[model samples]
Target: MKQFQNNSLYYDVDVKIIKQSEHCIFYEMRNDEGKGSIKSYQVFPGIKLTYNDFHMGQCPYHNPLHKDILEINHCREGRFECNFINGMYTYLGEGDLAVNTMVNNRIIDSTFPLEHYHGVSILIDLEDAAKMISPILKDISIDLYILRDKLCAGDRCFIIRAKNSIQHIFSELYTIPDEVKYGYFKLKVLELLLFLSIIDTSEQFEKRTYFQKNQVNKIKQIKQFLTQHIEYHFTLKELSKRFDISLNSMNSCFKAVYGIPIYAYIRTYRMQVAASMLLQSQYSITVIAGNVGYENSSKFASAFKAVMHISPSTYRKSH
Candidate 1:
């Protein structure tokens, strides 16, 4: 475990080493919230690719800023939340790519707004990675230092929302044959860096949504209220007045934080609860629909089918 701490990938976080082989290391962290595991592979010297699968709400990471390290993250599922030193909150939804170096932007901690996140992080020690640039490709050149400067110029952290180029690069990584995993990862990492190197920073960046601390807090309160009282429906105006936030701000901030609008989130949430009731409890479809805020069984059946893709009776019977 102590030896693994020296790895730039886990240097700042306190992770227990579960096991390690010649080229890969497995680490796990568990607390009251939940458990998570990180499987890291040494793709290249001073360059490592880590697969992060977390089932907890938050993971505490010490702010051990390393200027030589450049971090690239891709959110494959769920939502990633982090507050920067500037007191602003940023999020990464599915298919989003975030590039930042600790020197320019410091990540205070790792948080999953949805309580579970699956993603990938590529950690590059600029100095070390530069020294090990493979000579296998004669026509292509990769300079880690130059890449960092280009992407994280000044205090900027380059972010790209879901795009076809990003999708093309990372989608295959999630599903690779084990026999070719190591070799496949090297190819993908090189492809990603190459893509970043040539990308036009001015036109390719996404307009990232940054929320104020107060707004985030209030929206969280709104979310808690809505989830707790799923039996009732609230309009955007009603929630705005109840939470004392502007209408536009409420809609955008809620979408930014939770990756969905308030109504969509609550609708999915209600169906989820109703789903559990259908399976766990001996409740009638009408009773279950009423519990989730539907007065008319026909209307509830329509909404449930729209969300779950099956009628309530059929869903219950299928299981």
Candidate 2:
């Protein structure tokens, strides 16, 4: 039932809180521009949430309020920093989570240029929460109690996974009918709470495994960086420098994670962009080539043929 006032100068904002439960609710908000803007809402209380995916070089800031909300951030892509109270700072990369509690908090900063960050947040409304938990049975109370403790403990990974799952659930709410969406949203919220609850009881989820998780995180960051700056010609060396990894490391990571090298990935991404432009826009082949980071038309043609198995002109003709 809380109203959000639009403070963003970039666009008009509208937010809708769809469903509310003892723990969380569903919500949606949309920005009018639809460019670098998102509108979403959820009924999960106790968190004032802000989810943003921005271009490189932009630093987004949220000034601390007198009454602090429990803040959890997961960097799905790119890199950034969280500046806390008393000048404490933490750098977060993909798969990394950061937590700031009301007790000790400050501002957040993004360190990389042309970076993107996507994550979710859950703010606990303590006063309302007490009333909600009063009616639950002792067994159920165990989990809720544990979750509450961890949030107070400022468990970073726990918060990240919980918020990430809730955000995914919120995204799915948009497609379903109101009744079904509400039912599903509540289920997801419960799942998130239970996940947090288990985290409180067990220490297994806190340990980072070297399996695909770390590589997956790096891949997400690289892919997102590529998607946002598709027009720029990205060399392996440049990408390595941008991500603070070596060329061999970058290539191995991409190949192991994506089943392709960085160049092949970029080429495919470029060709896909070119195909969309060819079909959606009236830009000529030369312009499209330039737009996709190709300088020579013939070179672009060969690369396009290698990927699509057809020349750019032929592909255009077919489409």
Q: Which candidate ranks first by lDDT, i.e. highest?
A: 1
Residue range 241-291, candidate 2, lDDT tens digits? 877766765676566444456778788889988988888888989999999
Instruction: Provide the lowest-lDDT 10-residue window in model 2.
Output: 4-13
Residue-wise lDDT of candidate 1 within 148-200, one digit each (tens)?
88998875667888989999999988999899999999999999989999999
| Stretches of candidate 2 exceeding 4 Å from the true structure | 1-68, 71-107, 110-121, 142-174, 180-184, 200-265, 272-319
Clashing pairs in 1: none
Worst 10 residues of 1 by lDDT: 1-10
Clashes of 2: 24
Off by over 4 Å in 1: 1-5, 8-14, 60-65, 134-138
